[model samples]
Target: MVSARSVAVRARSGNVTRRLLTGLAAAALASATALTPSTAHATPPAHSAAVPAHALTGYWQNFNNGATVQKLKDVDDAYDIIAVAFADATGQPGAVTFSLDPAVGYASADDFKADIKAKQAAGKSVVVSVGGEKGTVSVNDEASAKNFADSINKLMDEYGFNGVDIDLENGLNSTYMAQALKAVHAAHSDVVVTMAPQTVDMQSPQNEYFKTALAIKDFLTVVNMQYYNSGSMNGCDGKVYAQGSVDFLTGLACIQLEGGLDPSQVGIGVPASSRAAGGGYVAPSVVNAALDCLTQGSNCGSFKPSKTYPGLRGAMTWSTNWDASNGNEFAGQVGSHVHALP
Candidate 1:
């Protein structure tokens, strides 16, 4: 099967130009400094209540894609970390900005910021997501890395965002991306850092996404690998598992779990409903079963782990809008199950 990510890239316009620019910028950045693995920054005190042990993360789309448009305050209580999707790329490379999608019906940016504060007050983390399937922002060099970190920190201060979500699906440079995230953590000691890499990106520790995740594992919250839109892939046991199965979820997750990621830093990411993605939609029951298999070693399919990860982080969905569109079945069932994980 064709790679779902490659297919999405082909369907969109300007990707070629974006890739070219990213390559040029990366070359310029690399020449300026010899890139090396980044050192972990000391974690600072959290700005607000810490995320729940077993949490649900959902993307709140900045633009409507036929799914229910929602205000931040209107997001369901099931989500503990609400990622505002697709922070816009700026003229300056690696810098990103966010504006409320007028389609979402917010009267002003102030209203949106207030909603963010309200969510933080309610113990939910509101983070600005930096990329999407079509995201073009690239952090390939020291300068771009600094720009990325500064801009994200600025957004956090301006909008009361607790942290940032790295969803740069197009491409990533592990060295500089790691540098940028370390700088952000240095500035906001208690920031919540999350990542949403596609399935192939985390297939091995050598992959850029996996490398970046490991570089900052000390302070990383979770790496919620997208398990949908991907066809068959190898799990930790080197078994080829197709998407939309209990084995698929548990098996792929084993790569991260066994590849040096803390159990609390690995999560399962799935589409909330069938309409949410091109393919690989599983019922919420399946998601819950996968969680059970990982954390409790029960409800497992053909593949089972050598040990249980009781501290496993929990699950994430593509978008809250899709969940609402599907009658909140994902949230009601999977959400409850995630919170009940022990």
Candidate 2:
């Protein structure tokens, strides 16, 4: 029993300076063979016509420890308010980024703390985003909440992360969800809890997912509403949020307000890559568009382009690699936007 209080730890190996892996990165890997319902209720969502948020965080999916270290460094160099995601000892299907070597093991929570310290030293705020779409663990009593809390506390003690992100997507809505979030905060007072959920559009509103989220509002930090790739009907509906897609963005804001969550906690999720093959990934939409105009052919894999969504916390990319062509040249474009914000 960790007692849900702060636990300091020592640095272990495989640690970064201050980057916290928040976002639904690992959930993407969990195999979704099923789903179950939870007992909770969320007030219907409502948005404000007056003030739309001015700034929101732009997250990047950096997985595989330092496999994408350079890529992450590139993102760090480019985006100012940067967010990278990591799997809390998870490896399976649809993972945004994960280590394949089962034997590699994770850096001790102390090591993560050190990493967070390093990140803070560099003047960056890092938060650990737990769980992804495979929120399947919550489905079973196999809830890793205890392990999650213990590991997070140890890491917090060592590194002092600004917050912990509770990203339980499609997870089995249960009492466990509240337990895990509250426990983390109880241990760490200043730790922020953010989440990214399925799209809250015309089709998604009917689901009980909103109710599940409303349960832990007190502990919830940011309820990042994704709009990039939101429209497509893929797994998790990757198109749930797309750049220049304000309609969906507004809908998400309305839900946050209706749910009584602070709108400031609402950050919108966007994709840097415009992927193809109906996966709702990030591929070069610009290159694809040029392909559409210059020649007349399928816009699949023909070109590699990056996104430039103006005025928000920042922009997020679907991943670090797709065609092995990123070449660490585009992170600055994304980083500059993040740097520009206060």
Candidate 3:
């Protein structure tokens, strides 16, 4: 979804770049359907908090792009995990700020802090997400990595964020990113860390993004690979699955599952609405189909997983803003399906 601060990617035709689509601009279109699940316990946060029970994850944009403008407290409960998107990086090393959009409703620092706690009180995880389609933040070296860690930790304390999300789209340094995360986790053992890498960034274990995931696998919460924006890609079976198809979702997810990622650490990321992404936008039923196929091994496409992963964490959407605009179809349909999983 195109947030006031996030850049939107557009659909493009090509062999290489097409396979790398993350989140971009696009017109709204008909949605697609479903998927399955697996069960594996993730390391709980250090605090006495509720285990992550819900599966539907959504991003709460700090500003309104086209949809209704709302604050973090205004987000729907359908989202089990809510990530606050696009924390701006200050030119000074690892320093960062919320960079709330001036065009939308505004909230004071205290207002944001209170809302974050309120969301947590209701069992929702609120995390500060760094980077976006056009995010400039990066931990390129050791010093920058330290800066990243210190800055994020400061934000966590100030905003009551329980975790951090690595949505850096432009580039990633596996070593530095891992170091920064490890530093944060060292202080707050319960901190949740999520990543939103493009499809190409996850194809193999060697890719930097994939390496980063592996580097932090022990403490990582979920790696929700963006399956939209991408055009077509090969499934685990070596067959190509086109965008917006159940085969595409299951097939791509299989790559992560079989590529050394634990079932609990991998999640399917899609647009809340066609408008939220340039290309891939499937109906909630289609998403359910993909989830069922992967987790239950029923109603599957041509390519099914060799084994079921009942512990599979869940699904993620581009933004809660679009979900709200689309009548919350994504969270409504996918949320119910994920919660019903074992």
Candidate 4:
């Protein structure tokens, strides 16, 4: 089929990990405890910038399944894109207000349309995300995949969505994952198809294959490389996520130079929160640490961006809710990123 909008994906998912990873360093707001309220920050007046198609703008899982329709409305005011995650074995997404009704065999167009309108109202790109570390790759099987693509298209057309993000984690770590993406790309030629692969740790040499997400899709834009910055150093004792920055930055730079991707296509992710010397997993504290460092500048490998990849696209967060009550902290960071871009 002759298509002007479609870009053919030709690369295969390989085990070559030579590049730097990118992603959000924000917190996941799906906690059991009642979230703290965001300390108010003054808005710099609402102004819209003409964001380029290749711009580094995004919305962490700002809204997940079960997100009150009202809650979605609140954060929709800040971000340009919205990410919705899906995994085969995991229960239904519990954070966003919209979802795919297994029984209905379709996505909720009303919410999607509402999202597009909100993005337009705010002057940003609105897209959907599929998959995460725990995301489901099986759903992309041919038959089920066809249903997914069709449903997405129907919803997009019905609602006027701008694009989609393919965050198919796990099983997608292979070349077949790239193939599946090719199929999804064929399904929607014009939508922006983004993939969030782990960061390439050149220093480690143990994870070279993921340097590329099996080389698929037209625009391999925006990588969310959450540093494997785990361990006691990850404790929640009020400190910066300082241990892994050097490696993360070093790896990110490698990706643009060695991996053959434009700098603007990469979005560096830092922990927007902080942890102690022994925190087992990333939590709100880890995100807080990252946010605390925003004043130095947005250019470093830290959660804050002194600027979008001076060489790549821009920055992004891993989730929508965690470190923030709404999206004040993360959105400000995004605003800084968009304005700082060259």
Local distance difference test values of all predictions, in order: 0.80, 0.37, 0.73, 0.38
Worst 10 residues of 1 by lDDT: 13-22
- Expressed as tens digits, the lDDT of each residue in 1-342 for candidate 4 is 001000110011101111111322122111101222121112111222333533434334333322122333554344444444331232322111134434322256566456557665676655666555444434433444434444454444544554456554344433333443333333333345555544422222234334433253133445544444332122122233333454234334344434445554445454333321111123332322332233233332433343333344444544444324433555565545444444
> Higher TM-score: candidate 2 or 4?
4
- Which lDDT tens digits does candidate 2 get at residues 1-342? 001000110011110111122423223112111221121112211111111122224344443322233233333434323344544444432222222232223345444445545645555555655555433333223345554555555544434545555445444444555555545545443345555554532123334445544655544545554444344322222333333433334333444444444434444454443331122233333322322221232232322123221222223333333212344323444334333433
At residue 96, candidate 3 shows an lDDT of: 68
TM-score of 2: 0.53
Model 3 lDDT tens row, 1-342: 222112343220000000111222110000100100011012323322533643677888765567656788778887877888768888877556775666556656777778878888887778888877766786878778777877887777667788788887778888877877767765455677888888888888999999998987766788888888778988888888998999999999999999988888888898888777778888889888988888899978888899997778889998888888888888788988988887
Q: After superposition, how far is residue 156 of candidate 4 from its true place, in Å?
A: 3.4
Alpha carbon deviation, residue 44, candidate 4 (Å): 36
Steric collisions counted per model: 1, 50, 37, 56
Best by TM-score: 1
TM-score between model 4 and native: 0.56
Q: Rank the candidates by TM-score, best first.
A: 1, 3, 4, 2
Among all candidates shown, the one with the greatest lDDT: 1
Clashes of 3: 37
Per-residue accuracy of model 1 over 1-342 as CA lDDT, tens digit each:
113322322343210000111233233244222332132223332446788778899988777677888898888999999998868899999999988778999999999988988888888998898877767899999989988888887888788888899988788999999988877766565678999998989999999999999987767888888998888999999899998899999999999999989888988998888877777789998999999999999999999999999888889987898888888888899999999987
